[model samples]
Target: MEALEAPPSLAPDNRSVIFTLSIHGREAECSVLREALEQHFWVQPGAGDARILKAFADGRKRITAVAERKLRAHSDEQIVLTSADFEVRT
Candidate 1:
């Protein structure tokens, strides 16, 4: 799985859009895109089973509160949004 995942949307400029793509080539055919994804990296969160592994696995990490808003779909593959819906995160 990717360390970070972002849905494509118009960038902060409101004219340009950034896309998140997965590598599709072998070690030789992929270089440019690989470097681009590496340059924008996000650390993975530690999510372990709460019974035992959770405490021991990442006991040192702080758990942040996450507020979730249900995502609605406009189509089978598209999302419904207005100009106010665009959000870019690190």
Candidate 2:
């Protein structure tokens, strides 16, 4: 995340703020999510992958929570979530 300041040549009152957000590499995780989506929804493959990828791109908190839950369930041995973990029972 970065913010750029207005140039000095610009009038103070007319100045506008600029913000830039950059997301670093997560290729492996994205691949895993893609595979999971393909396996879970064969009829609509790649559909849910976009939503999950967008969640990652937007830095949603739910993704972190899911990871934390997975870690806790594994007693810190590993962090992993299978298709079942993503299913809603109800």
Candidate 3:
């Protein structure tokens, strides 16, 4: 029998988005896209089970643009958004 293990954790300061990806045309292109996103988002520093893009310093649109540039297909992936704070606009 296998022993139970504890689930990984996230930092209290962390905020990010999760994306599912797919690479078409060439398999090698996938790494290129991943590298681009890492350069763009800087990925979350330190260890965790989560695969997420670090929040953009500028705002939400910048993050969306990054996703727009990287996402090649409309049907193959998912992006989950989270807000650090909840706000009501008039």
Clashing pairs in 2: none
lDDT of 2 by residue, 1-90 (tens): 111122112113312111121223211121124343344434144344345444343433443445445544554243444456566788
How do all models score by TM-score? Answer: 0.21, 0.38, 0.24
Clashing pairs in 1: none
Candidate 1 residues 1-90, lDDT tens each? 121134333344432223332222211110111122222222123322232222222311111001012111121232222222323556
Best by TM-score: 2
Clashes of 1: 0
lDDT of 3 by residue, 8-47 (tens): 2233444333332223432211111222334444544452
Better of 2 and 3 by TM-score: 2
RMSD of each: 15.7, 15.1, 13.4
lDDT of 1 at 27: 13
Evaluation by lDDT, superior candidate among 1 and 2: 2
